[model samples]
Target chain A: MRKLVFGVSAFAGLLLACTAHAQEITVGFVTSLSGPASSIGINYEKGMNAAYAYKDEVSGVKIKLIKLDDGSDPSQATKNARKLVEQDKVDVMIGTSSAPGTNAMMTIANELKVPFFAVSPVNVPIPADGHPWGVSMVQTPQLMVKVIADRMQRDGVKSVGFIGFSDSWGDLVYNGAKAAEANGGPKVLTNERYARTDTSVTAQALKVVAAKPEGFLNGGSATQAALPLLELRKLGFKGPFFGTPSLLNRDFVRIGGKAADGTQVSAGPVVVTSQLPNDHFAKKIGTAFHESFKKVNGGEADDGFSGYAFDGWVVFLEAAKVALTKAKPGTQEFRQALMDAIYANKNVAGTHAIYNFTPKSYFGVDERSLVVVKLADGKWVYQP
Target chain B: MNAQIAAILAIDGIASGAIYVLIAIGFVLIFAVTRIIFVPFGDITAFTALTLASLENKQMPGTVGMVAVLAVMATLMEVFSLWRKGALGKIPAALFFYLALPLIPAAIAWATAGTLLPTPLRLLLTVAVILPIAPLLNRIVYQPIADATVLLLLIVSVALHFAMSGLGLLFFGPEGVRTQSLVDFTTFIAGTPVSGQAMLILGSAIFFSFLLYLFFNFTLYGKALHATAINRTGARLMGIRPQQACTIAFLLGSVLAAVSGILIAPVNTIFYDSGFLIGLKSFVGAIIGGMVSFPVTAIGSMFVGILEGFAAFLSSPFKDVIVFSILIPVLLWRSYTLVHAEEEDEE
Candidate 1:
C-alpha cells in the first residue's frame, strides 16, 4: 500500500511539471523566403515578427512561432505544411506568398483539420465542412479589380490592355477585370502573358501597344511586372499604368525607377495609412503597424503585403485568446477550439480591415477593404 | 501586320540580336583558342551591367571587392609558381602588370562611385572595371589545367558558369536592374521609331567586327592568335606562346561582354540569373556557325532574334520553341554535308 501510494504521487508530480511548460501555443508560418516571391515573403516575415513581438503573450499562454521557407514552390509548401501539422503539432497555421502554394497548403489544412490563414490572394473552393479549415487574410482579386474599375471610370479610360504572369493569379485578375466590364467598365483590349523569370517582354509590349489601349493593367507582382511597363515605355507608349495588389512593395518602385513614377496600384487600405482619415476603422492600428514596421525595417513603411500578414496574426491571436479559455495548448481539443473561435469571431479590427469570418465564408473582407493609390515622388499617395 | 509594325519589330530584333552576336563572338574566339565553350560569357555581361547599376545608384560596386579578392589570389599563385621555377626575381613585374593594372581602375571607379562624372567617363570606367576579369580568370582557373582534354575543359567551363551565377546572386541579389540609357533620343527610320540605343547597338557591332578583322589581318599579335588556334603544338614549335595567345583571346572576349552589357542595359532588365538563358541562346547561335565562323554566328543570331520576334507576335508563348527548333535542322544539315574529322571519328 505504501509503495503504491508513493508511485501515484510521483506520477502526479511529473504530470503537473509537464503541463506547466506545455501551456505554450505554437503557430507555423510557411512562406517563399528564397525564390522569385521572396521579396513579398520577406516582408510578410518582418510584419508577422513585429506583431508577435508587440504581443508577446496572449491570455497567459506563451506563443511560439515556427517559420519555414517554401522557396516559392508548391511542393515545398505542401511539405512544410505536413511537417508543421504532423511533426511539430502546431495548433494553428499561417503562410505562403503565391496562390498555387497557398492552394496546396489549403488541401493539407483541410485533411489535417488545422486552421490555415493564407496571406496571399487565393480562391480555394471550400466544401461546406471545410469552412473552418481555411481563412484568407488577403483581399480577393474581385475587390482589387472593382477599385481599379472605379478609378478607370473616373479617369474615363475607354480601353485597357492586360499583361501578367501566365498563372492562376493572372487568370484571377483577368476574370475580375472581365467581371468589372459587365458594369460598363472599360473594354479589355489585349491579354498577354510572361513568365516570372523572363528577361524581355518587347514582343508582347509591341502587340499590346499596337492594340491602341488608352491604359495598361499589369497583372503581375513586384519587380518582374515592371518589365512590361518599361518595355511599353520603350516602344514609345504613352498611357497610365495600373497594377494589382501584388505590386505594393518598394521593390517595384525602386526597380522601375523613373518609369514607375505615374503608375497606380490597387491595394489594401493600410498601404496609404498616412492618408487615411482619423475616423476610418483601420486607421489607428494601421498607423501603429506602419510605425512599428518602419522601426524594425530601417524606416521603410509597411506595404500591403506586410499589412495582410499583420492582420492574419491579429486574427490568429484573437482566436487563440478565446481558445485558451477552453483547453490547454498542444492538444487536439485546443486546436478544435481555436478553429471554432476564429469562425465565431466578429468585428475584429486589424491593420488592413475589419475581420468578420463566418462558417459560410472564409474571406472576411470585400470591395470596401481596398483602395487605389498612385506612386508619386517615390511614395504611395492615396487617390480618394 | 503592316510594313510599319514589321519594320519596327525588325529594328527591335536587330538591336536585341546584336547582344547575342557579341556573346557568340566571345564563344567562338575562346573555343577556337582554348577548346572550352566559355559558358560564363553571359554571366560576365550580367556582372558588368549590375556593376554599372551600382555605380549609377551612387553605391560602390560589389565588383570592387571581387576584383580585390581575385587580385590577391592571382598574385599569390603567380608568386608561388615563380618560386617553384626559381624565377623569384620576375615576381615584381608580374604582380605589377597582372595584379596592379586591374586594381587601378577598380580603385578609381570606387573612388568616383557617387560623384557626378561625365557620361562618357562613367561608361569608360565601367568598361575598365570589367576588362581584367578574363585574363585573371584565365590565370587562376584555366592556366593550371591548360593541357586538359576538351571534355574536361567543357566541364570546367560549366562549373565556372554555375559558380559565377551563384556569385552574381550573392553580389547583386535577385532584383532586376535597368541602367539609364546611354543616349536618350529616338528617331524615325522608314516611319518606324528607332531609339538611339538601337543605333548604338548596330554601330558598335559593326565597329567591333571591323576592328577584329583589321586586327587579325594587319596585326602580328592577331595573326599569332590565329596561328595558335590553327594548331597549338605548331604555334608552340614556332615559338609563339600558347598561354600568351589564350590570355589575349580571353581579354578580347571580356571586353566584348562588357561592351555588349552596356549596349543592352537599356533594352532589358538584368537579373542575376538572366545570363543563363541569354548565354544558352547565344550558344545555340554559335553551334549553328559550326562553332567557328564569326560572320556565320552573327547572321545566325540575327535570324534567331527575327524568328523570336515574329513568333512572339504570332504566338508569344511559343517563341522559345520556335527559336530553339531552328538548331535541329541546322545540325541535321551539317551532319549530312560535312565530313567527320579523323580524331572525332576515332572517338
Candidate 2:
C-alpha cells in the first residue's frame, strides 16, 4: 500500500509540472477596429494575424492573442491598455494603430512594465531615457524624411511646399524635413495643414500653387494624403510630389489614380523586397513574409503595414525567448525580462528594417532601411 | 495673398458654395412641403457620386440593389393599403407608380452598365437611377410619419442619414473616389486660371436656381406646391393632394442633390461620409435664409463659401471654426431684429 501511494503521488507531481510549463503566453492587442482609422487598423490586424497563423506556437508555449478595439479614440486606447495589463495580465502588448493611441499605450506599458510593440507608424517621440517598455515596428520619421530629402538633393530640386494633417503627424514630418533641410536638402517654402477627414484642401493647394515650389511633400496617409495631391493636380501645379512612408499603400495609388503618378514616397524594404540587394538584412525575411502574406491574403501584395506586424512578431518572439529563459510565463518577472531582452538585443533583423533597439533608441531603424519609390502606372518603381 | 492667389481662392470658394447652395435648396424644399429637414441630403449626394463612379467603371451599382428592395417594399405597402380600403381599382396604378417607374431606370442602368454606351447617356441614366430614391424614401419613411411633428420628422431624417452613410461605407469601401471631370478646359479669369469644371458648377448652379424661380412663379403645379408649403391643410381643403406635392418637392430636391454631387465629385475626393459636413454647411446657410427664400439661401451659402476660402488661406486649421462661428452672429442678429411670434398649434 505504501509503494502504490508513492507511485500515485509522483504521477500527480509530474502532471502539475507539465501544466505549469504549458501555461500560454498572452499578447494583448488594442486598435481601431471600427472608425475613420479602421482601414489602417484592419490592414495591420490582417498582417499580424497572417504572421500569427504562420507560426502560432513559440518555445513550446501556445501564444494566446486577446484583441480589443479602441474605436480609434485616444481615451479608449488608454482604457484598453489598462484592461490589457490589469485584467488580462498580458505578458506582452501590441498595437493601437494611430499615433495618439500608440502614444497612450506606450505610457501604460511603462507603468505596467510590459513590453509593447507598436504595429503602425507613430508620430509622438518615444521616451528616450530608458526602455519605455516599447519598441516601434515602423521606420522612424527622421529616416523616412531623410530618404526623400536626399533624393530631392540628388535630383537637384531646390524648393518644396508642404501640406499635412493638423496633428502630431504633421509636426513630426515637418520637423524631419526641417532637419534634412539643415543638411543642404530642399528648402521648404510654404506650409499648410488640414484635418484628416477633410474633403477639400483647396486653400492649402492654392497656397502651395502660389509658392510654385519645385516639389511638394504631403505629410498625410492613405486617402487623406491623396486629397492635397488631387487638388494640386486640379489646380495645375504639375510639380513632383513627395510623401511619407505611410502613403506607400495600394489604396493611395488606387484612390489618387492618374494624379498619383510620378508621386514619390519613402518605403520600407518589404515594398520592393525583390529589388533589395542580397546583402541587405531585411531582404530574406521580407521576401518570406511577403510570400506568406500573399498566400494568406488572397494574393494581396505585401506592403509596409503588413510588414510591420510580421516584423513585430519577430521582435516579440526574440524577446520572449530570452524572457522565458530567465522567468516562467504569466509573471511580472517574465514581463520585465521580456522588456530587458528587447532593450539588450542589437541588430536583430526581421522584415521592414534591421531592428537594433537599445536603451535610448527604440525605433530601431535609420536611412539604411528606407528606400524612395515613385508611383508610376500604379506601381512602385524603386529609385535606388 | 497676391491677386492671383485671391482669384484662385475665390473661384474655389464659389465652386464649393455652388454645391452647398443645392443642398440648402433641397433642405428648404423638403422642409417647406413635407416638414422634414432632410438629413440624408449629404448621404444621397455621396450615393449619386458613387453610382456615377460605378457606372463609369461599367459595373452595376449597389444602388440598383437598394432600389429593387425599396421599390418592392413601397409597392407592397401601397397594394396593402389599397386592398384594405376596398379600392381594388387603384392597386394597379399604385404598382405602376411605385414599382414600374423606378424599375425602368434600374433596367436601363443594369443593361448599359459596363457597356460601350456614350458617356452622356450613361451619365443621364446615372441621374435617372438616383432621382427616384428620394421620393421612394419619402413614400416609405416620410409618408407614414407625415402627420408627425417637424421635430419628429427631423429625428427620422437624422436616422436615415446614419443608415445611408453606413450603407455608403459598405457599398463604396474606405477609399475615396473622384469622378472624371465633366469639362477639361482651363480659362484665365482676372489673370487667374480656372478649370472649365469650376465654371460649369458656378454657371449651372445660377442657371438652375433661375429656372427654379421661373417654375415657382409661372406654373400651376408650382402654385400648388407653394400652396402646400404655405399651408398643408388649407391646400388639402382646396382639393390638392398633399402627398402628390410632397413627392414633387422630394423629386426636385433629390435631382438638385445629385447634380451638385456630380459637379463636386471632380473637384475633391468624395468619401462615404463627406456629404455630412457639406450638408451641415448648407444647413447653416438654409437657416440664414430662415429656410424660406431661395435667393437668400443661395447668397448666404455663397458668403459662407467665400468666408471659408479666406479663412482657409489665413489659417486652414481654423477654417471650420470661422465658418461655423458666422452662424452665431447671424442667428443672434435675426433673433433680435425679427419679431417673436408663437407658431400655430396643430390639431
Candidate 3:
C-alpha cells in the first residue's frame, strides 16, 4: 500500500499508477527484509532511499518508491517480480540482493522483457549466457580473478593452499582463485573439499596448516568454510586466511572472532562514503549514510546492500522519467523508453559508487569496483 | 624420521586421540542404555562450552553466580516443559528452545564480559548445567522410546537433532563461534611444538572412563542402573525401581555428554551444528569400542583420533577420505566378526 516514487522498489506496477496523468514516473523496489537475510537486504534499501533523496531531481521528476519484500525466498522473489510487472504496473523494477533470487527474476524479466539490475556475489559463476534484461552492478567472478590476483601478488603472497566446498558455488570461486593465482607468485600447495553439511574440517585444515603455506583460501558460504579457520589456528598456521566476498559476511566474524582478525581479502568495503577517494560528494554521501544507517539499524551501515538496491530504484526512476517522454503515457512504450535509458547509462554516482551501465556491458566492475579490504577489529578497513 | 620427530608425531597423535576418547564415552553411555544414537548429545559440547565462555560475564563472577545461571536454566526448562503439557514434554521443548537461541545470551554475555572464566571451572560448570537435566530427559523421552526398535528410536533422536539444528539457525543465526578461553598451552619441547589442551582432553577422557568403569562395576546404584539397561523388566522383577534406574542412566549419559563437550570445545570451536558431528563421531568411537565397554570405547575413540591425525599428516588434501575409508572398512569387518562371534557363542 506504500507509494515511494523511486522511493521503495515494489513489485510490477505500484509505480505505474503514477504516469496515469503522464505527470510522474514510478519504480518498484524489491528486496528481502524479513527473512534470515533481511538485515542484509535492509542495507540495500538504505542505498535506494538515499539516492531517492534527490539533490537535483535528475530522474525526470519527484520519484515514488513501491517497495516489495521477497523475504530472501526465490519463489517469493518470482511472485514479487510478477507483482511489480503486473499489478503494481511499475514502469521498471530494481533490486533483489541474492544470486539465486536475482537469477529467478532475471529469467522472469527476460521473458517479460523488463530490465533487472543487481549485485552478483564476487565469487559466483559467470552467467556466460547473459540475459538481455540482466545487469548486476558488481564485478562478476570471471573478472574478480585479475583484481584478487593483482592484489595478492602486490602483497607478495606466494604458495597458496585452497579449502573448497564440494559444490558448484565452491568450484566457481576455486576456478577463479586458481586462475587469479596462476599468473602470480604462490604455488597452490593443497586443495581440499567437503560436502555442504560436513562439520569435520579439522583434518582438511590440518593439511593446509602443516604445508607451511604463506596463506590459505577457502571457497564456500560462511557456515561451512568457517570451521577450518579455527582448526588451522589450533594446528599453528598463523598465516592469513583469505576468500572472496564470502569472507566479508558478518557470520564469518561472528563465527570466527579473534580467529577472523588477521584474515584479509577483497569485497565491497563497508566504508563511510566520504572516506572514498573524493572529498566533496563522497564525504557528504558517506556522512548522510552513516547517520541514517545508524538511526535505522541502531549501528553503522553494513556492506550497503539496501543502499545499492535503493540506487537501483534511482536508475529505474531516471529511465522511467525519460521513458515517459518517448512513449504514450500509460502504454508499454514507457517500459521500452525506461529500458533504453538504463541501457544508455554511462555514469551516475550512486551510494555504492559511481554507477555505470552500458548497452554492451551492464556490470560496473573494472579494477576499481572491488579492492582489498581486511577484517580488522571486527570491521572493514582498506588494505590496498 | 629422527626419534625426536617420531616422538612429536606420537605426542600429537596421542593428544588428538584423547579428544576422540571423550566423544567415545558419550557414545558408550547412550548405546549402552537404549541403543539409541542421540545426535543432540553432541551439541552439549557446542552450547555448553559456549555457556562456560559466557559465564564470566561482567555481571557474574564466581561459582555461585554460575550455579545461579544453571538454576535459571533448570527453572526455564521446567516452565517450558509445563507449557508443552507436563514434565515429559520438557525434553523436546527444552532442546528445541535451546537450539533456536542457544548462543544469543552467551554471545551477549561474551560481548559484555570481554573474557571467559578459568578453563577448568568453565568445563565443570557445563557438567553442572547438564547433570541436573539428564534425569528429566530420560523420564520424558528416552524411557517411553525404550520399547521401540532401536532404528525407530534413532529416527526420533535424529528428528530431535534436526529440530534443534533448525532452531539454532533460526534463533542464534547461522554462524560458528570460537572458545576465547585458553584452550591450549602450546609449547615447543626440544623443538617439537605440542598442544597442551589436546593432552588435557585425552588425559581427562582416560581418567573419566576409568572412574566410570569402577562406578558401574563396584557400586550398587550403578549396578542397578546397568541391570535396568540390560533388561528393564528383569530389573523391575528384582525389586529395583526401573523408572529411577532409567533416570540414573539418563543423568549419567548427560553428564558424559557435558564432559565431552567441555573437552572437545577446546579442540574445535563450539557451534550449534556441531552436536550431530560430535554425536556421530563419538558414537562411532563407542561402536568401534564394541558399544558395551567403557574402557574399550575410550581406547577406541583415541585410536580413531590418532588414525585421523595420521591421515591428515599423510594425505593433506583428501585427509577425511583416507580416515573414513579406513574406518568404514574396519567397521564392516568388525560387524562381520561380531556376527560370527554371536553364532559361535550360540553353538
Candidate 4:
C-alpha cells in the first residue's frame, strides 16, 4: 500500500514536470540556403545561428528552431512555410532571403494566422482593417533610398540616372526615387533596366551617359550592381554613384574594383557600428551581436543581410518573452498572443535598427535607423 | 541617340555577338556529330572562366577535383563496356585515352595552382583542364543511349545542364568573378572608343571560324567527322568510327567554349550559373540557323546581339521578351520552307 501511494505521487510529479516543460517554443525559419541568392542566405543563416547562440531561451521557456531552405524560389518558399506551420507546428515563423520569396512566405503566414518576421525588405500589404500578421525586419526601399536622395540634394546634384534589374526590385527602387523626387530630391533622368545574369549593361550605361546626369543611382544588387557602375565609369561619366544597402557586400567592392570607390550607399546602423557614438541605442546591442557573431561564425559580419536576420531573431525573442506569459506554446492562443506582443513591441534595440512595430505599420524603422556609407580602398568607410 | 552612342552600342553588340557565335558554333558542331544538343556547352565556358579566375587568385581550382572524378567514372564505364564486348585488348588504350589523358591537365593544374604562372600558361592550363569535361560528360551521360532519338538526347542534355549547374554551385560557390583584361587598351573605332578586349574577342572569333573552315575543307579527320555527321552508317562503312567523330567534335566544341570564356571573363562578371542564359541565347541563334548552316548561325547570332542592344535601349523591361520572341517568326519561316522528315527510332 505504501509503494502504491509513492508511485501515484511520483506519477503526479512527472505530470507536473511535463506541464512545466510545455513552455518550449518552436520557431520555423525558412531561407535560401542554395541557389543564386544562397550568398545572402548563408549570411542570414550565420546571423541566425549567432543569435541562437546568444540567447535560446526567454523567461525560462526554451526555444526550438527548425530551419528550411527555399533555394531562392518563391513557390518553394511558400511550400516550406506551409510545411513549417502544418508539420513543425511552429509558434512563430521567420525567414527568407529575397523580396519575392519573403512575400510568398508572407501569404502563407497570413493564411495560417501565424506571426512572421521577414528578414528581407518586403513590402507587406496591410488589410483595410490595419492589421498584418507579418512584419519586415529590414527597412523599406523608400526609407533607404530617401537618405541617398537627401545626400544627393545636399551634394547639389541636379539630375541622376537610374539603372537597375528588370524586376520587382527595380520597380521598388524607381518608385522610391520618384517618391523622393517629390520631396526635393534630384530629378531622375533615365530608368534603364538589365537582367541580373546579363553579361553587359553597355547599352544602358550608354543611355545613362548620354543623359549626362550629375549623379547615378544603381538599383541592382550583389556583383551585378557593379556592372553599370563600371561601364559608366568607362564611358567617362565621373558623376557620384549612389546605391542602397544591397551594395554593402565584399563582392561588390571586389568586383567593382577601382570603380566602386567614392560610391555611397545607405545602410543600417550595424554597418557603421564602430563609428557610431558610444551612447547610441544600436551600439550596445550591435557590438554584442558582432562579438557573438565572431564567436559563433569565426568572422566579422561583412554584410547587412546577416544583421537583418539577427535583428529579426531579436525581435522574435522580445515578442516571445511577452507571449510566453499568456499561454502555452504550440497552441492557437499562444500564436495570437505572440502576434499581439510583436505588434506591441516598442524601442526594441537590435543589431541593425531600433524597431517600433505596430499592427498598421509593418516596416518598423525610420530615417534615424539608416546611415550613409562610402566605399574607399576596398573598404566601407562611415560617412558623417 | 546620336551617332556616337549608336556606334558604342554597335561595338558592344558585335563583341557579345562574337561570343555567341563561338558558343553557337560549338552547339551546332556537337549536335551534328553526336546527335546530342550538348546543353552544357555554356557550363563548360563558365567552368573555364572560373578555373582561370581561380588560377589568377592563386587558388586550386575545383576543376582539378571535378576532372579527376569525371575521368575515373569515364574509365570505369569504358572498361565495363569493353569487357561486355570482349574487347579486352583495347583496355590499355581506353585507360590512356579516357583516364590518363584527361588527368594530365588536372595534375598540371594541381601542381601549378600555388605558383605564380604566366598569364598565357594559366590560359592554356584553363583550356586543358576544361578540354576533357564535355567528352567525359558524353561518356557518362549520352554514350549508353547513343542511338536514342534527338528529343531524348535533348532532354538528357537539359537534365545534364541542371546537374552541371548544381555541381557548379558546389564547386565554384555563388560569388561572381571577373578576371583581369588580357589587353588593356582602348582605340577609336570610327569616332567611338572600343576596348582592346572587344577587339580580341572579335579577332579570336574570326580566327577560330577561319581555322574551322580550313580544318573541314583540308583535314582528313575533319572530313571523317563531317562524313559521320552526314550519315553515321555510311561513315562507319567507310571506316570512320562515329564515336571518334563525336569525341573530336566535343573537343573542338570545348576549345571554342574555352576561348570564348577567356575572352568574356574580363568583360563580364561570370557566375556559376551564368552559363545557362548565355547558352540559351546562343541556342536561339542556332535555332535561327535551323541548327544546320554554320554561316547562317553566325549571322543569326550577330542579329540577336544587335537586336538585344536596341531592344534593351528601346524598352529595357521587354528586352528578353523581344530577344526570345525572334524565335517564333524564324521557326514559322523554317517550318514553311523545309520539308518535315519523319524521325526514325534508332537502334
Candidate 5:
C-alpha cells in the first residue's frame, strides 16, 4: 500500500510539471573543422564537444547546441558568428581554434551584445584592457611561448634562430619572444620568415644553419613546422628545437620519427577526460556530460571545442537559472547578474580547466598553469 | 677582400651556377627548338626532388639509376602517344601535353618516397625524372607556341606557369624534399675552409657542361637537332622531321631540369616554387648569352649564378635586387639596340 501510494504521487508530480511548454535555449559554436589547421582545431573541437555531453541534463533545463565550421579564415568567422546570432537566435556563442578567427568573432559579439567565450586564449593581456564579455579556455601564446623559452634558457641555449610562420598567429608568438628579451635572455642569433605554404624548408633551414645558432624556436602549424624538423635532422642538426602549441600533435611523432623525440611544445597541459580519474566532483559531472552528449551526438566524449560549446551552454544555463528567478528580468539586469555570478563563480574545474572570470580581471586565472610538454616515444608524455 | 676570398666567391658562384645552368639549359633548349619556354618546368623539378627526398628518408633499398630508368621509360611512353596524336601541333596538343607531364613527376614522388638512393645515382635519378619532360613539352605547349612570338607565347607561358604552380602546390603542397648530402660540405681546402657541397656543386656543373658540349657535337641525333634549330622549314624540306627534332629537344630540356633538381637536393632544399626564379634567371642567362646560340648562355649562367651568390651572401634580404641588377642593364642595352635596328625580336 505504501509503494502504491508513492507511485501515484510520483505520477501526479510528473503531470504537474507538464503544465506549460519550456522556453527553448540555444547555444552556437564555430571552429575550424577542416583545412591545414585541422590538427589543432579538429582535436580541440572534439575534446570540447565531448566535455559538453558528459552531463545527464544541463542544469534541469533542456539544451540545444548548434555547431558551424569556420574554416580557419577570420573573415568567414565573422559571417558564421553573425548567422548564429541573427538567424539561429542563439543565446550564447563560442569559437575559433586559432586567434585571428576567434578575435573576429569576438568583435562581432561585441556589436551584437552577446556573451562570447574563447577556446584558445593567449597569455597576452587582451580581454583585460577593456573587453569584459570574453574569456579564454586555453593558455595564451605569451604564456605558452615563455614556457618553451624558459626550457631552452635552462638548457643553456645562448644563441637561437627564430623561424616564424608568416601570419598573425606567427606574429603573436614572435612578439612574445621579443617581450622575453627584457629579462636579458639568450641572444637571438637570427630571425627567418617563411610563407605558410613553404614546404621545402631546407632552404630556410640552410640559411638558419649557416648562422650556426645553437637552438631553434618555430611558430607555425604542424606540417609547416615539421618540414624544418626534417631538414634539420638531414643536415645533422642535433640542437634543441622547440615550438608553440601548434606543433603539438601525436601525428608529429609518426611523421617526424626519432627526430621528434627531443622536440618540445608548450600548452596549458590540459588534463581533460570524461571524468577526472581521481577527482570526485569532476568524475560525477564529467560522467553526466559524457553520457548526455554521447546520447545526442552519437559518439564517445572528448574535450574539444565542443567542451567550450558545452561550457558556453553551462554558463548560459547557470545564468538563466539565476536569471529565471527574476521572472522575465530585463536583459540588462540579467546580463549584469550573470556577470556578477561569473565574478563570484568559484571552483569550476573544467576539462579546458576551471573558469574563474571576474569583472576587473577578465582573464581571472593564473598564467603559470601553462607547462612545457615533450614528445617521448610517441605521445604527449609530460616531462618534469 | 683578398685574392683567395675572391676565388672562393667565384667558386661558390660556379657551384651555384652549375645547378642553375642545368635548369637553364632546359629553358634554353626548349626556347630554341620549340621557340616557347615550358613554364611548368620548375614544378617538374620540385616534384622530382620531393619524391627523391621522401624515398631517401625511407631508406628503401634501390639504385638511383634504376629509379631514373623507370621514370624515363614511363615518360617516353607518354611522349610517343602525344607525338602520335600530333598534340604538339596546337592548343589541343598543349592541353594534352600538360596532362601527361605531371603523371611522371607525381609517380616518381609517390613511388620512390623513403627509398635511399646513392648520391651520384640520386642525381642521375633526378635527371631521369625531368629529362623526358622536354620532349613531351615540345609536343604540347612549346611546339604549339613555335609560330607564336608576341602576346601569344607570353600568354601561353604565363598560363602554363599558373597551372603548374597550382598543381605543384597541390601535389607537393609547397613542401620540398630534404635530401642528405652525398658529398660532405664541411671541409677545409689548403688553409681555408670551404663548404664541401659548394665544391661538389661546382664540379657537377663542369661535368654537366662537358656532357652538354659532347651531346651538341658528336651525335648523329645532335647534328639533326642543330640542323632543325638553324632552319626548321629547311630541315623539314630535307626530311629531317623538324617535328621530331622539336620533340627530342623538349625531352632533352626536361632532363636537365630533373638532373639539376636532383643534384641540388643533396646540397640545398628544392622547393615547388624554386623553378620559377631559376627559370626566370636562366631565361635571363640565355638571353644574355644570345638566344639562338647554346654555350654562350650556359657560360653566362655561371656568371649570373656567381653574382647571385655574392648578392645572397652580401645581404640575404637584397638577393633579389642583386640578381636582377644584371638583367636590367642587359635589357636596356638590348632595347636600345633593338629600337635602332628596327628589331625583329625583343631579345
Candidate 6:
C-alpha cells in the first residue's frame, strides 16, 4: 500500500513538470516568395530565418514560425493573413515586402485583432475608435527622403527633376519631396513616372533633361531605378543625383556599374553597420544580426531590406517576452496582452533602429534611424 | 519640344521600334502557320538576354538545362505518337530532329559555360541555347491539340506564358540584367547623339526583313510554309507537311526573338518577366496588321514606338494607358473592315 501511494505521488509530479515547460508561441509570417517583388521578399525571408536562428525562444517559451507566400499580390496577402489568423491560430503575424500587400494584410489584422508587424514602410490610417493592431518596422518615405531634401538644400540646389514608379511607392516619395519643399527644399521641376517593367525610359529621361534642373531625384527601386540615371548621364545632365532608400541594393550597383557612382541616398544605419561607430546603439545588434545572417544564409546580407526584417523580429521578441508574463500562449488574452506590450515598448534596440512604440504612433523610429550614404566604386560608403 | 529634342525622341523611338518589329514578325509567323498566338514569344527573348548575361558572367546558363529537359520531353512525345500511328520507320528521323539537334548546342554550352569566350561566340551560344525552346514547346504543348480552334489555341498559349514566366523566375532569379554594348561608341546623327548600338538594332531589323523577304520569294521550303499558312489542307494535298512547316516557322521566329534580345540587352534592363509588356506591345503591332502582313506589322510597330515616346513626354504616368488604348481603335477598324469567318469554315 505504501509503494502504491509513492507511485501516485511521482505521477502527479511528472504531470506538473510537463505543464510548466510546454508553452509554445506560434508566429505566422507572410511574404512574397514569387513574382516581381520576390527579390525583396526573399531577402526578408532570409533575415527572418536568421533572426529565428539567433533566438528560437522568448522567456523560456519555444517559438513556432509558419511561413506563407503571397506571390506579390495584395489579394493573396489578404487570404494568407486570414488563413494565418483563423486556421493557424497564430499569436502574432509578420509580413510582406510591398506596400500594397502590407496594406491589404493590415485590414485583415485589424479585423481579426491580431498584432501585426509590417516589414515594409506601409502607411497605417489613423483609427477613429481604437489603437491600430498593425505597426511598421521600417522608416517612412517622408522621414528617409527628408534627409536627402535637406542635403539638397545644403548643396544650394534650386530645382530638381523627379522620376519614380507609377505606383503607391512613387506617390509616397513624390509627396515626401513636396512636403520637404514646403519646408525649404528644392522645388521639384517635373514629376515623371514609369512602370517597373518598362524596357526604356528614354522619353522620360529626355524630358527630365530638358527641364535642366540643378539636381535629379530618382524614386524608383532595384535594377529598374538605374534606368533614369543611365539615360540622364548619357543625355549630359551633369548634376547632383539623389535617391531614396529604396535604391539600396547590390543589384542596383552591379547593374548600374560606373553610372551609379557619386549617387547619394538616404538609408537606415544598419545598411552600413560595419562603418558605424563602436559606441553607436545599433552597431552591436547590427553586428549580431550580420553574423547570424551569414551563418543562416551562407553569405553576407547585401541589402537593407533584410535588416528591416531582422528588426521586426527583434521588436516582436521584446513584446512577446512581456506578454508571456500576463497570459499563456495561444489564447485571445495573450494576443491582446502582446499587442499592449508592443505599444508599450521603449528603447528596443534592433539592427536598423532603436524602436519606441506607443498607442498613438506605430512607426516607432525617428531621425536616429536614418543615415546618408553615397555609392562609389560599386559600394555604398557612409556619408556624414 | 524643339527640333533637337524631337530628333532625340525619334532616334530613341526608332531603336525601340526595331525591337518590337522583330518580335511582331515572330508573332505573325507562328500565328499564321500554327494558329497559336504564341504568347511566350517574349519569354524566349527574355531567356536569350538572360542566357547572354549568364555567359558573360562565366556561369552555366539555365537555358542549357531547360532546353535539354524540353528536348527529352519532345522526343518522348514524338516517339510515342509515331509508334501509335504505326510509323515506326520514322523513329530515327524523329530522334535526329527532336533530340539530337537541340542537345548539340546544350552540350556545347555545358562544355564552355565556365570559360569566357569572345563576344561573337557568346552571342552565338546564347542564340543556339534558346533555338529549341519554341519548337519543343510546340511539340509538347500544342502538337497534340493541333486541330483545335484558334480561340482554344490562344487560351493554351496564354496558359503557357504564365508557366514560362514561373519557370523563368526559377531559372533566372528576379533580378534584372543589362549586358555590354556590341559597339561602344556614339555618333551624331543630324545633331542628335545616336549610339552605335541603336544603329545596329536598326540595321539588323532592315537586314532580317530583307532576308525574310528573299526566303519567302525564293526558297522552296519557305514557299511551302507560305502555302501551309494560306491553306493547310491544300498544302498537305500538294505533298507539304503542315507539321514540318510549323516547326520551320517556330525556328525562324525564335531566331528573330533571339537577335532582338541581344540587341536590346545593352539598352534596357531585362528581367524574368519583362517580356510580357514587350510582347504585348508587339502584339498590338501584330493586331494592327491583322496578324497577316509582315511589312505592315513593321510599320505599325514603329508607329506605336513613336507614339509611346510622345505620350511619355506629354504625360508619363498615362503612357502605357495611351499605348494600349491604341489597340481599341485599331481593333474597331479591323472589325469594321474585315469579314468574320467561322472556325469551321476556315478549317
lDDT for B256 (candidate 1): 89
Segments in model 6 whose C-alpha atoms lie over 4 Å from true places: A1-13, A22-38, A52-90, A98-105, A123-129, A295-298, A320-331, B332-347
DockQ for every model comes to 0.41, 0.47, 0.26, 0.65, 0.09, 0.71
Give the CAPRI rating of model 5: incorrect
lDDT of 4 by residue, A88-204 (tens): 899889999988999988888888899999998666577656667889988878888998889899989989999999888899899999989999889999999998788789899
Candidate number that wins on lDDT, 1 or 4 = 4
Candidate 5's residue-wise lDDT over A1-384, tens digit each?
999999999998887755322343456778887653454676556654664545324436555667888877788889999998889876667787877888788777667766677775523344533646656666566777777777778878877777676566777777777766556556666565555433234444556676788888886665446666766776667788888776764444555667767787775434334222454344454455666666766765433345555555555555667655553322444444555565566756543445677655435444444456677776565554
Highest TM-score model number:
6
Model 6 DockQ class: medium
Q: What C-alpha lDDT, on a 0 to 100 scale, does residue A142 get in candidate 2?
A: 77
Which lDDT tens digits does candidate 6 get at residues A1-384?
Answer: 999999999999998766754488999999999887887899999999999998999988899899999999999999999999999899999999988999888888888889999998666675666778878998878898898898899889998999999998789889999999999899998899998778788889899999999999998987799999998999988998899888987788888887789999998888889998889888899999999999999998878888888898999999999999999988899999999998888999998788988768668888888888999898888887
Worst 10 residues of 3 chain B by lDDT: B58-67
**Model 2 C-alpha lDDT per residue in residues A173-249, reported as the tens digit of each score:** 88888888999899998768887656568899888888889999888877668888888897788889998887887
Choose the strongest candidate by DockQ.
6
Q: What lDDT is obtained when candidate 4 is compared to the true structure?
A: 0.89
Per-residue lDDT of model 5, residues B105-126, tens digit only? 4455446666665666655555
* Candidate structures ordered by TM-score, highest first: 6, 4, 1, 2, 3, 5
- Every model's TM-score on chain B: 0.96, 0.97, 0.74, 0.98, 0.77, 0.97
Clashing residue pairs, backbone N/CA/C < 3 A, model 2: B58-B114
Models sorted by lDDT, best on top: 6, 4, 2, 1, 3, 5
Q: Which wins on lDDT, candidate 3 or candidate 4?
A: 4
